[model samples]
Target: MVKKIFYNSLFLTLLSLTSIVMAQKQYPINYFSSPLHIPLYLSGTFGELRNNHLHSGVDIRTQEKEGFIVYAPANGYVSRIKVSAWGFGNALYITHPNGYVTVYGHLKAFNPAIIAYLRKIQYEKESFEQDLAIPKYKIRIKKGDTIAVTGNTGGSEGPHLHYEIRDEKTEKPINPLLFGLKVEDTLLPIIQSIKIYTEDVLHDKVLEVKKKDHLFSLKSIDTLLVPAKFSLGIATYDVISNTTSKKGIYQLELYVDTLLYYQHTLETFSFTESRYINCLINYPDFIKTGVKYQQTKILPGNKLSLYNKHINNGWIELKDNLVHKLRYNVLDVNGNCSELVFYVKKDSSMQKIPLSPLPIIDSNLLISYNKIDTFCTEEVKVKFPAEALYEDILMKYASYPAPSKYYSKFHEIHNIYTPLHKNISLSIKTDTVADSLQSKLLIVRIKDDNSIIAEGGKYENGFIKTNINNFGKFAVLIDTIAPTIKPLNFKDKTNISKLKTLEIKITDNLSGITKYKATLNDKWILMEFDGKNNLLTYTIDNKILEGSNLLKVVVEDSRQNVSELSFELIKKVP
Candidate 1:
């Protein structure tokens, strides 16, 4: 008995040593620190659940609030700064001198120098969001400088610093924890469900591997079947130590009957193929239902990637009745791992679907229907052509109510969620007028749930087309939410020389702020308002106000929430 245990231990040690020697991991670490004062208090670890690309960065908790002074992780410069409402509200990009850029997202504000510089350029260009690429020598910075204050900004669900490190040349996002951010976590990863994706060209496709007794097995009845010699794909998520929360697995090593076939370690990845995530997972099947089934095989037309090490073909060439032993390891920052063992016996099983669609629904799949004008989840989107509201609303009753925009051509594109209902109604409430010309000539179509093609066609009137297909949400965006206003350093019936700049904050929940203006005694003043934060500021140098100046401010949101404030300020000439 003792000899058997000893040999098992020796075998594991040798295997570990072999993996270390054979598997080449380029730790993308450039610098080091314990992101938090005492250590790391990560509420969200790297590769956690997110809308896209697996959580790229870890969210360092701020003790339940914002205003933590954020410093540069390494020597870098102000490479980029993004100020927006929904995601990464106010973010700072600092490019290190060492061919890498450290990113800080969801910030409150930048330091004085950065603020002044940003405002100057914003006023000069008269635009809020302008991406500037300065020479590394131009926008320089030092380590430990208070670059930004932590806050709940952008697409943040809470107040935390969303930090990341990206390779300068390849621009691949690497884990900041790799750079020596001593996040004192001792927890090993948790192994969740192991999923297998079988190839299917007809109808829908999905399969699941569940655990029973001490072993994992496939679902008894499934339609997903693969042919002999045709490879398979596996999708799995891992957890970290000190937390059993599922996270992105660093690497998934595949062996066919103990013969190494493929190794996919996320040490680095290109931004170009990021969208291949849809292809990597069983996207269409996952959309129709909830869970995901990952496949190990890289299908044709899928330019995703295969960081293969041992074999030319990452997938195994199977024979009839091929029984294979598959092993997957889940690792954390310190390389501590948890192992999951499973077997795949060649079986041609198919998935079964009931003909009846889910008849009940919770809400319409709505996206970014509030303050700002979000076109198609992109920067500039067009929600007209009124036809999206009527007969063409795709899907039964699928809905993704998350209203956010993505960067794309023509301003932006605000995507709707999948439909979960038999039908839906798209209602629009505009402030003044819908661009009837554009809205009239526009044709509306929806990307349905089951089908990859955008279903529905040009419909008359403002009705969204409806169906039993699964297209998450429906939107013929005509602004409905109002813009909100917050005043900074307010004064009433007092001499106003004390405050040089009239700073007012304007924020819109949705379509964002379309237009904003501040007037003293009914006259225009030179001031800049960052629509991202809804902040309005008028430097006293631009326009002088006389005695008992009536300060009037008007703000309009995408839904056209016009808020006007009137106050009197007395100015004493120095």
Candidate 2:
């Protein structure tokens, strides 16, 4: 047994060394200027832990409002311009000649020249969302040139600029701060709490941390008694000089008896590996307590590239009853660091206590992460892809009678605490309904708060099928209601050419809006759709006639429910 442990530790050490060498590549400093003219502060950090993914770039705060001029960082060509209702709403990508790419997202608007070019395409395509790739010679940019204006567009919660630097070839985002963009941060990271996991324990234990004289220690506990094999997790965050926002730490190192046992740095990571964040964090704890704890131990399927060093996958095994010193060092990108020291002793009387067996249900199935599997009940069927799960689990499932307003039984496939890496195909058998209403049938996930979220599905052979990434209570619900369209600025025949822009609000209660179109005098007009605000706006341009104009708008929901609004207005000015 001792020989096996030693060999495993040696193998891990070699792997760690190889990773360290791979991550030693130096970043060029001062090559790119700050995207904003004002002082830069962070609302979200690169590699920060987010829902089901790591934040790919830093979010630069915009003073809680929009319309700040965004400048080009360096000489580059506009490589890509993507405008959409969600996810980076108005994003611009610039590819430099030096094989690097800079991305600016969540912009309110692009400069006039770019807007003219983009509007031309939007009018041609008759679509509000577009992803266009510009030729290298078409739109060239120079350093410090005004490119865009910042806003809280897309999936952003507030006014901020999501900035990124990437390798042009690989398209993987690198930390923008590494390029010499600076933020004032002299404060060290705070160690909030720690969790100790033992091999023989069913539930891990959490301990709050207290600081004294610039060092952190466990509150009211000098030493902890644990079994032979154990691991650790920490809830830590950093703060900037002027902001109260808690940001992710840049680096974490764990030491056992003053020897480095594990370390991970927030450097560059691939987009494909971002979902592995579910494995890096204590997922169940996050779902339970809403606190994300970065676990020191690496899971079997966690292939994230952030770990630069580790020994035995960060599992420390005590061979004797001697008390061992454990230490954690957490640091921010500016090199401000905090240290926590504690002690643990191996329990000499410890024995392997067998874990209680999970309750055996007739429909329970063992799902493995390495292979695809399917589970079925009388009214429901689920197909899990090989990558859907992070580890093996004994799936617990149940079913209850259909609730009011539902067409199918309330099927409980699994608990929501466990996270899935990929979408799983789910098909639920529905009660007999009129064939005409089948088009309105869609699956809805019931949240813990009793709110229902639409998970659109298609009806096929008496079943409503959908692909879902979360596990929870789901049932078939019908949405026969069309979206509501309300004019915010002008109504039918009430405009006299004074309004600079026409605004309308479109919304749906159940199934979300899928498509919308606006036309003036039977010609397609460019109307920007903001899904977050459920508002569509069209700036009055040369497209409107001087005397009279007919405006028509059409919108549709996911269930094909349609809404239309038509109006006529006088435009006295050209």
Candidate 3:
């Protein structure tokens, strides 16, 4: 009884300390206004699980249309503007006086003043993509000032404003909702299913789940009767008011009887640790079932900061035939919550299997966390550096027939489902390829849908070498074709008097475009490239003359295959 009391006291002390620390970290609520003019609705929320990182910001809905005016939420200065083909294209960063920075992404166009400044830099540098850090005094903003217009510029599927609030000092993203950015949300998070797994002496075993009307029950009730150790996970999501998009839960608390056994709140996280989301979920299950199940029990390798007050890493050990109550409390950012209750009892009817060493499939395996691991086969070799993986895993390797288009054999380094903290070096020998095609050889990754992504590699010795993070079907392919360039609105040597811009579509058949340059009358001109549409646009300005003008465009592929287009156009002042 005394030992139980001591444990309870320690747990309470940790819980109280967590609450106090959270309460002390305050923010300037009501200092910022809604970034959009329309009613606030969310397409994505902060802390949401994404492909390889947590969604660091909230995606504000813009009525499913582009060109909506986005405003400055607080008084700040434009810290930086990043323009890219993917990953938050045309994003703006502003540093405020309150030690906070606001980010606005997927913008169609900036304000006229800002646009002029950016265009000047683009022309000076002769580049379309740039990461510019502006001085604070150069561009100042006031609260509610129009900054930019929203669009689906980057990796977005639709029109929405990706907004974020980050700590200026730590550069860590904090939940924007914590700063009094209010949205209508009354719906509680819904729990769709639950999973339980056990790590017995024999090996790890997966337990089956039975679901009905959103209530999940364990199919292996007989296994729970045995006194053993187990862990749990949940498949749940949140729906904001007037939005059908499923979002991540903000907080989760697991309770044993009436005491809090474990708790995790999505308050803030570092940008570096964002990739740890893969370890936070049941990655193997997600790969097989296509459902994301957040593991309630922290893995031994997981280093995410969201978990706190964890008792025994959220793993419950059943030692006696006594019934224990389990409760799950899930909440949204708006404080709306849902509760789930269940019971577990120990039974001795289930027998425990004895432990035995399994036979090693290959003697060349290096399965240790302390040192770098290197695995190889006849056709392919992989080199994993120290700390590339969170824990030691039995690295799997296999080689099969390559696709009809590929020149080398298909190599599967491991399951694509597993996440890696760092990249692994992959090398494939190309002895089968003709010597003439060696210069055009490069590695390509084939997705499940048979789509090809060029993993640019260089030929060294007799092998094509490159760094890869995800494990999939990889093989060597040759790219002998040059990129294609065609004018979209005008033909060569034609009058473009009424046209306000020169637009060209650039495409590549094999390797993607590497570099492109546009020149007018043998002088460099700034051409904005929108990667999504494969369009290169040059707005007519003082740079163009009234008479017949020569425009030259040169595009190069990854293999240095170049294509050039030259045209003379007659322009008149409107």
The numbered model that scores best in lDDT is 2
lDDT of 2 by residue, 238-264 (tens): 888889988988888888986888889
Using TM-score, give the best candidate's number. 2
Sort order, lDDT high to low: 2, 3, 1
Q: What lDDT score goes with residue 547 in model 3?
A: 86
Ordered by TM-score, highest first, the candidates read 2, 3, 1
Candidate 3 lDDT over 386-439, as tens digits, reads: 767767777767787865777788887777877787788999987566677787
TM-score of each: 0.65, 0.94, 0.89
Give me the runs in candidate 2 sitting further than 4 Å from their true place.
1-23, 359-364
Candidate 2: C-alpha lDDT:
0.87
Q: Please report, in order, the local distance difference test score of every candidate based on alpha carbons.
A: 0.54, 0.87, 0.81
Decide which is better by lDDT, 1 or 3: 3
Q: Clashing pairs in model 2?
A: none
